[model samples]
Target chain A: MKNPYQDLPATAYWRTAVADPDALDITGLWQPKFPITMTDQTATSGSCFAQHISRAMQNHGFRWMDCEPAPPVLSPESAKTFNYGVFSFRTGNIYTTTLLRQWVRWALEEEVPDSEHWERDGRVFDPLRPQIEPGGFSSVEEMHGARAVTLAAIREALVSSDVFVFTLGLTESWRNSETGLVYSNCPGTIGGEFDAARHVFANDTYPEVYAAMADVIEMAKVVNPAIRFLLTVSPVPLTATASGQHVLAATTYSKSTLRAVAGDLANAFPNVDYFPSYEIITAVPYQGRFFEPNLRSVRPEGVAHVMSQFFAGLRSVGVEVHTEDQQQTPTAPPRRVPTEEETADDVVCEDEILEYYNAH
Target chain B: MPTDDHRFALIGDSNSAGIGRVARSRGIPFLGGPLSNGITLDGDFFDVEDGDFLPRVDGPQAAGFTGLFKAGLPILSTVGFNTQRIAQELHHGFYRPRGLDHSALSDNVLRQAIEDYKPGTVKFYRAAVEEGCDVYAVYSPQRFPEPWMALALRLERLLSGMLVEMGVSLVDVRPETTDEAGRLRPEFFTERENDQTHASDVWSAMVLDRFLDDAGIGVMA
Candidate 1:
């Protein structure tokens, strides 16, 4: 009997396939089982890195889908301040697989996280997305009204889009155990009052995380049989950790667990695909230059590199998508998040609140 | 980072602007510095006994006159109007003066003014945060007569509560300026109608003093 390695192409070996991890041409590293054409309506969500996918698609000449576009009255700058056009919908930073599942369930009316609104000085804040509204919603009724629009947008994306790309960021999160509701950030850190007895800290185990990822795919597939899922894990590190472990250890565990989940999903489901945007930026070959001084934020060139590989992979298959569309726009240079974007990180990290409290 | 540059900012309705006007009129430097007076939270309208919502600023503002609102201090204004309302009014064009003593002779033209003002209110306050300024929203008592008082109270709730939600400290100057009858003192307004409300210089100086004591940092000395 012939061993499986005998017939495989030289591309399988470290010597041939990955000759120099440092100068590795990452093109063709990812190929989807189900092709995502340029014409497909694509929806993007998850961590801050996911914004790159949406933006890249916009500049790369794909028909990037936006269900709830910003009103023309708002400038692109101001519109982004309130999270308009950041993703397919306005559900700011889905952040985790669990939160993604939670949003899906809410949109499908499968589960309703209690009608919980945290109030400060009479302004109402939705705990699910504390900063979605800058000064909180004017009233609980207004909060609900805006929430209704988001839920609708979410449902539209889930059941209708041809491609759904999610970039999972963390495993640790705080939840109200009694209500079985996961909050956007730990209460008291940003807006809600911290209640020791009521709020519970959770660092989700692999099985828990994997189940969420798998279940959402199954659930969404049922709703829209044609929907395809593409997954990426954010390369950003954890900002702060509530677990007793050191933040470095916590970030490693979180990212690794999420990566495992993405890998597993890609292996299990034919329709689900995993892209190596994570590997291209985080791998040793690049010498970590893709990251900024904080060693967290991905340099703009890093995003540009990831998209280069993304389009390159498709081009190999004779797909006239990524390149054909780019001819018209010639793809603008990567709009990297500079160190000055310390504030833009708000959508990605509430850990800054801890830093603020400690400094004060 | 230089410690001297940590900035503080003021944002709110015309009342906050009024205090700035008052300080400039008196020939005193802007009043947000070191504390001198004993911290006396005389008539703070905040009902901390019920729930603590506002940021911890010394609540002496409106200290003496908490009694004027015998029925209840108008925390009702805490729920007052937001930029959304202003935006809506802009879309619809001029809001009729209603019981406000100001004439709406050019209601349409007045509405055109929304094109300039609503974003001003929202953007400036947001700037206080963007520029990392320590925000102290000084709310002077700009009272209105009977029927209009209810609407004015709601507007107050909206504006003050907005600042508080955005994590700004409050200095309710009502205790110093409001008459027992729920109207601005006869002099704060440029005219008896209370339409063109402007605060006096002395009133501005007192507010700045209270703010300095609350913030515990001021450059003007």
Candidate 2:
């Protein structure tokens, strides 16, 4: 029983990994991403890792596309607080792959209607950015308006992106029972009470997750038809768990599943590539010096190494790929919610989606 | 020798809850006050409703609004888009009241909240608890509300007693701020000439001073 994916020659995960635009660069494949100059405009999303990569790339003079930088503007104490600027004019923690794509489509103007409360009202109320000061906003409606402005800014970014990098974070998610919407956080933790009726459990298997990743590729194609995808697995662990398992184990299961799915999707989509940021930081024999005291944030020195390899690989292989002309770009239509009829054939099985990468 | 987790909760109207700026050259320090322990504030939002006597909690339009109290109470009335919309309409810088029954709704809200989390005032009274705080406190800054500026002091004393019996430690500053006229001194409202319900910096500091002295928690003048 041989795995067909294992038997095939690995492809270059970098833009210039191939010496000739047609050559392969597997050694450089799946290494951590370091921002490099590409004529292609890029959009970054996913977990905390994506945030770092986006910042590093922006520093490298590569355009990271999203209008709202993480902290908006660096404060006087920004040196102390380590400001990343306001990410999406809102907060930039793309909790799921679906959210990452939603942000991308929204940025590209391919989507206008938000996931109702999720992108609009739901973003400002994100527990990650606590309102320590009063006199800022007294009502949630005011907060909702603030979030709408943020989404508007993110939507502006997607209009002219060429490369979209997404880091898949988790498989387990809490989906709203009625709307079938997935929440980044469970009820009672950040938002409100956890009503079993309002939210149900969904821990996507490898196939389901892979299919979702492919769907994101398809959606990005719909937006630019020529957009390239670079997928990575988040190295961070789950902060807490509702999977009835220990937090550490839950994190492992989530990451491994997401990693496999990323790999599977990459094999299927010629334009899609997977970067092994998770493997380099966590599994590779790094001599136990990669993680911080909290076992969460990666050491800056380690990140610099991961990034160095990424840049070196790109610089060494100078392969030029065709970039879509900005002027000739087709005007994408406003995003509409998929009707039940449109999503009818969307009842895809878990394995059907994974069949590309897991070929026997 | 404190061992049990003595839980302390704050329950009351916006003023007592300390909604405004706490610290400024002339204002009260919101973060550094006695109310600084695990304070979670959920402000009410106003809906499109027309009423005066404060409709029942289940009444139309009133029920659509998200809050525990009714009547254009200081906290509930000044919420959502209604606050700004009203300000634009009135042009007088006054908050309009879409009044609803405050007492009944407050009772139901507290009762429901306690039933869900057994650590607040309900647990303090219903169970013969000794350790861990079931005892809570509520603040009401708008107790003296606008127009009836004359009854501010009387209202403060009335609210203090009611809140204290419900296991909430009351911070009543009306007695000290009241003038010889026995009316709430005008200086209490922050934006005095406009919206007279919200507390001013001077009044908030006075409230903080009394809170520290009464609780004997820390060193503050």
Candidate 3:
């Protein structure tokens, strides 16, 4: 009698797939569930690592939808300083699923955040996206106005996008003790005063993360029934942990929880799929070679490798991967592809600000 | 003109040139008759034969308009001295300073741009202040009654705020020159059909009268 595992592919065995092959040569890491064609309007938001995916999609002549583009007057440098074009909208780094859920609710007019604005040195900041406007807005009215624009953009993006790629970043976040509003960054790190009584640290368990992400998908599908989700777990470890555990252990917990949620969501929803970027970078077979000198930031080569696998996976599924050169022939209109200097290792991670408080 | 031996210098761009034309037409004797003869910050008079009154300075002159400052001439300048150049730059794209309506730029970005793109009127005011000359910055009338002129209006407001912060007196003539709809009144438009970016001599006369009133200088009857 033949066992179920007796005639499996080489990819199913650790020795043939990982142990025997060179780390970089390992294949079949991801089999894309659906085809991501060039014409598909894709919107990306989540951790800083998600930026690479957005930029790569643009660079490859894919239609990476940017609903809230920087005004034409801004130079590329100025646009970046103002946090425009960093993500599909200006909701910088939706690190936690609950924050993602909150943004979706605001976009769909289902919820409103209690904290309107935070003030420091006479300058106002939007509590939802504190660091979006550099040096803060001039007034509370201006902060609200800017947030309204972003919320509108979020709505447009959710409704218009054919694919929404969200890289789940962390399980740990800070929340308002009373309102239960989640902030993108710790209150005091970027703006707002951190009070022990008013602010509370939250390390979401697997169940909470799962439910929030499911709600996000359900809410998005309500607006855009055809929208497909591609989820990934960020490989960059947590910069600091409010949990009493060591930073390393906290990172493992966060990554494991996020990874499990992503896997389960992909299993639960036909439209949802997981890409193994976290495992591709962090797995023992790779020996941590993809990290920078600090052993935290993903190197440019690592990003390139992950994208190669992404494109390769699409091609393996018979999806024609259209390159920029092929998409933009002599008759085609010009499109702006960010230069290598702009996209290379230029992820804006708000959590990295926490490292400033490190005693070491 | 009063012969009190008090000298006055008119400085700025085409709008200032328009004022000079009106003053010349009215036989008013200003130190620089036609400001088309551009005066540098160092007080050197150079003819800008092209009729572009941007006050482009060259050659060996001090950093400040020392000659006119030393003469203690009350300087009447137009806030639009460098606005034409800025308008040309902005034609490449639209950029509004933050806090204004429809603006996407932050104050920090606009502040950084000031070093590279400070208005000529502001620069002139600073030089005159160093020499203790009484300076009056006239807010020029809107050149055109078009939607694109909104940026120009916003820029004028920005410069006006800067001049006020520097304690430079400002003569606002918009109430008289602009219509109820916030456009330049058609009566103040130039005779040249092609030139919409310059006000007529009628507008200059009104501005000059307002400037004279604010400066406390009496015209000969």
Candidate 4:
């Protein structure tokens, strides 16, 4: 009688799939649940690593929708400086599922965050996205007005786009104890004054992360019944963890919790699917070669490798991956080549701002 | 009587050129030709028979016009309301300034505008300061209606702030030229039927009086 494991694919065995092949040549890493055609409108939001995915999609002639684009007057340099075109909307970095939930709720008009504004040197800052406007908004009204515009854009993006790709970044976040207003950054870190009595840190557990993500998916489905979600865990480790554990251990815990939630959500919802970008960057077989000198930032080569696999996986599933020559043909618009300034190396990670607070 | 010694150089677009034309037609004593070729006294005047007037200047003459600042003349620069630049580039035909209640472009665009939307005319103001001229920038009179007028006013405000920062004085004629709604009064518009977007000779005369008064120069009767 044949054993139950007989005739299994090579990918099922560690020696054949992980150890035997050259790290760069690893083939069938991801089998995309659904095909993303060139015409599909893709929108991205989440950690800084998600930026790489959106830029790669645009560079390859894919219709990565920019719901809120920079005004034509802004030079490419100024656009990047003001954080335009960094993501689908100017929500800055949605590092946690709860923050993502808050944005979605605000966009969908299901909830309203307390309109608390920060003031320093006479400039007003929005508590929701403190760093979005450099040097702060000129007034409290202007901050609220800007947030309203972003909320409108978020609604438009969710309703219009066919694919919504959200990369899970961290399980840790800060919130208002009274209002349950989850902030993009800790109160004192970016702009607001730290009130120990009011501000609280939360390292979300696996169940909490899963429930929040599930809520986000369900909410999005109510508005956009056809919207498909593609989830990935960010491989860039946390710059700092408020959990009182070693930064490395905190990073592991955060990534593991997010990864499990993402995987479970994909399994629970037919429209949701997980891409192994986290594994591609952090797995032992890659020998930690994908990280930069600090061993936290993903290197440019690593981003390229991940995108290459992404396109390869799509092609393996019979989705047409348009080549540069194909994109340059007369009928199609020219693919937007990423400018030197927009290179993968230049991601805007608000968490990196925390590095300044590091005690030597 | 204003003497030839008090040289007044008017530098700007067609609106500035239009001012020069109005002054010439009224037989106001002045001098000059095209701004690209430096301003000189051509002896074309009813009174003060030998005074110098600045030449007709447009955007192309910007380089040479700014250079004239070194001559230590009191220059009235009424430029920077190019309809093409305003409609196509600055506002893309539909942006509103921040803090305004009206719905226009998204606040992200407006916020970015607040930070980085420096008009191309800023370089000229900067050049005027670097050369140490007695420069005064007249806010470009609002000529269009509603949205365009609002955008022009916003641009005027931006240019005004930059001018102040660079130590250039501003000539605010809005109180006289604009109606209560902040639009150019219909009567102040150019008399030429083909041109609906320029200030009239009457409007020009009023602004000229203000400039002369601010510059502390005697106006020729």
Candidate 5:
């Protein structure tokens, strides 16, 4: 036979697929290897953009595995702001591939980094997830108690979930120079004081990030060999880059490196697959309608557009990705699908938080 | 108000069913069939269906409460279902039917077994009392894994407060597995897909023994 593309359909062509970026269905954007049934227990984590994936999954009536759920009494607004029920666990935004690796080791390998709790004005904070407990912990003991449950929940999520979705956010991060502990965000920006020597700004390289991404899937497979991974790169630009490179160049490098890692890993491993959320929001054809006024944040419509394609992409690959909205029982009025903006308010973005400091 | 008709009906969800499982695994002999069907303990032919969580379970298999207890039996459903569906049913019944995520339904068999215990218990309690029986209630924690665990723990606390406001006799069942911290043994309810995952009948019987021993339940006669 000739080349594989010779017999391929029009979906393989750029003019047909890429000619109109405005078209809602970017046919052949992705071809999923597995089906995502409404019954599939999906566990979400990783970058802030990952929350968008989770909300879409929830809105579609897909089972989103929540290892650490908030109390029912807490209003959705309050629960999200308090950093509860946002992710599978309260580990906050796992922005960097490096940090994601650290969490996997801690949860799966019993490797707890030399722990140090940051205290400010008599409030204790977990450097790994500084904003998890809104007001910060009252005591180191209290912080330890809460983190214990979170760690247990993380372990449970890893083992219980059928599919794990992780959105690669950045290649730049802040790490503990001494212990090699990866902090969620720059410490000084959130809770802890910045000691220049103690805190080192790390711009993870393509090789390192690529290795960590593979390690994450490998580690997850050890616990649940059947577990599948759906990888996406956050389209959100860098809030601020600590690297010596210009902020725009830093963002381009960070995203491209993470994107390459996702594509390569998906190519390397059968269980690993990549979704084109980055292309959906940032691709030139959509006229940049998905971004907010700031040009940095994804717009609500853009988030919606990405999710719509998410399911569509899976369907293109012969996956049985059904929306509960289509077959809902008639007894009740069709439930409202939460707009991306409604869900966005509750998003926990440490990078966007970093942008807040620069806003003033 | 308590009488020689010391008959009782269990009203809770799967935790309540755990007793029957324990009863059956050990072949605990009773007057009728499995408790989910019918059973007569201590000469009281309990209408097993009224209390069991299984669907369509009722008095036909055994003696209906009216037939067995001419003087009627107090209804006490030992509810300890820690689930988001029941929690949402009680707290936010509005967004239900489609709004509720069905994935939780598949992972935890008990999530489908979720009943709005507050109203269900009250309705069961009133119906029992109207039949000339006394009414009592009990609240306890069920060991659950993940997402359900946190919600279940919080719901348990909420259920305790509910028992107080409703003025129901709150009997706290401490099975052999429960510790001083009031936490149930996590293993008792883990691996919930299997029938034998909860506390054994011997452990639940300790709960029955505790119920009989409680001062609130004055009709030991």
Candidate 6:
């Protein structure tokens, strides 16, 4: 007898029980196992999401290669300014796969014809991490030297690091004209000229994204033979979109394409793996527990959820979970408090203050 | 006991020396500086026994040489008013090792006073060794560096062991009145709105009360 529910298999019915209603399955490309583990001195560099990964590595007892760190002794204001992370300095938003590719290519010091260097502020900027200073680099030479040294140092550090955790942040980025280098944030975010001619936005396709990741992974392997790559698409929605499309649609498209690319790369490269950080935060039915009041920064509970999955993945593969629970969480960026609107209830007369003070 | 024969030294910095008008009214005499009737009881000069300052008396008070012999305490040479005067006396060949760069500029002056006024501690200890005599140490208000408090704690441990060698116990006023950050406790100030480290009349009375408590002395009515 023919089964009545033949077309929709019993397995398909189970999706309602476990899977997110919005979960789009690119699982055919790469369905990760429960636990995965790798022992590599890891370095994270990318967009703001990369901060989370850096923190996670530090928390999880993973060897975090702080390729660059601000001087240990610094005044609070100096510490705030010299923002340390990737390459021991804050180079805002290393968005886009091509930019990520450029970072790896430059870090390896390989001859990539598209390499462009600029002098601004006191340093040089490669397309991978452009020099962002308020007034711009002092001279072209200083800028170029800085870029060269930064690239050289990163390559040197990568040669010894085992894992490179790259978080795909934005598909939109600004590129240089004569030299095809990428700038992190636009010049104005820190301080520089915002000339449209000097930059082009990269709304990359999935194939382009895949190729970029493959190139970086290949390049990283050359530096460190055992280099493993893990990719996660940042769940942070777009602040603005250059794609002329609706910002919401553009965000979906950007995330979807990157997610597809990540799946493709994980399938293609045995050493590469995809973590469901974006999924855990966005669609895992975790409710709204993860995001801060501003809908940014994974709430402590959300971070715990992600870390739990991460550790579960490690445990499944027999990787020892470093038992430092206290250190396993990274500090979240400060939440922006909304100002309360003034109402009649807030209005207090000066006479009241004097009256109260005298009585007290 | 003869009140004229008695000497009462209040040693410290400008704060201890009674800098402001509000601080001047404490019953202690202002021996080191010129006197004007800033306030009635706050005369700018101390009533003296010879040249050295003596405690003031409102009534007839007389005694004999036997009281001095019985007390066996050192002749109190009060230098509480100004550290500068104490620094001068010690540096002007009073102590063999000149009070130059002893620790800090402030500590140097204070240590100089200690050396120059050995008569007070020595005589007090001699009297108290077999019988009973009153001796006290007081710290004046000053802003101390936060980091130095920790260093001072360690130094105090070292100083404590050395104090035994010197045959005396040292009392730390820091723990009693300093806030956690090593600043003088805000509550200690009566005239808090000003920059004065000098105690006000109320604060002076409070400090004097604490001193009498430690010295086992009754306030002279």
Query: Model 2 chain A — which ten-residue stretch has the worst lDDT?
Result: A348-357
**Candidate 1 chain A least-lDDT 10 residues:** A347-356
lDDT of 6 by residue, B27-87 (tens): 5332222111111111222232332234232212111122432333332211232222223
C-alpha positional error of residue A147 in candidate 1 after TM-score superposition, expressed in Å: 0.8
| Most accurate candidate by TM-score | 4
Model 5 clash tally?
Answer: 3
Question: Could you tell me the TM-score of candidate 3?
Answer: 0.77
Which CAPRI quality tier does the interface of model 6 achieve?
Answer: incorrect
Q: For residues B83-152, what per-residue lDDT tens digits would candidate 5 score against the true structure?
A: 3334433233322332333222211112212212233443443334445544455554454333334455
The model with the greater lDDT, 1 or 4, is 4
lDDT of 1 by residue, A73-123 (tens): 344555676777898988888888888899889888888646998999978
lDDT of 2 at A247: 92
Model 3 agreement with the true structure over A51-147: per-residue lDDT tens digits: 9999888888788988887654344666787788889999888899999999889879998745557999999888778888778887776677677
After superposition, which runs of candidate 6 have C-alpha atoms over 4 Å from their true positions?
Answer: A1-39, A75-80, A86-90, A112-145, A187-190, A287-289, A326-360, B1-221
Candidate 2 off by > 4 Å: A1-38, A69-91, A101-137, A319-360, B1-221
Pairs that clash in candidate 3: B41-B64, B41-B65
RMSD of each: 16.6, 22.2, 12.1, 12.2, 17.3, 22.2
Instruction: Score each candidate by Cα lDDT.
Output: 0.63, 0.46, 0.73, 0.72, 0.63, 0.50
Q: What local lDDT does model 6 show for residue A88? A: 31
Best by lDDT: 3
Residue-wise C-alpha lDDT for candidate 1, range B37-140, written one tens digit per residue: 10111112123222212222342322322221121211111111222333333232222312112221112222223223344443434434444445565654
Candidate 4 structure quality by residue, lDDT tens digits, B1-221: 23454457776544565556565555664422123210111111111112222233333332333335445677776645443233334433224322223333434444345434433355556655766677777766576544445555665565577568889888778897788877788888766544545677687777777887898877556
Could you give the CAPRI-style class of model 5? incorrect
Task: Give the CA lDDT, 0 to 100, for residue A51 in model 1.
Answer: 96
Considering DockQ, which of the candidate structures 1 and 5 is the better prediction for this target? 1
Q: What's model 6's interface RMSD, roughly to a tenth of an angstrom?
A: 25.3
User: What would the DockQ be for model 3?
Assistant: 0.10
lDDT of 4: 0.72
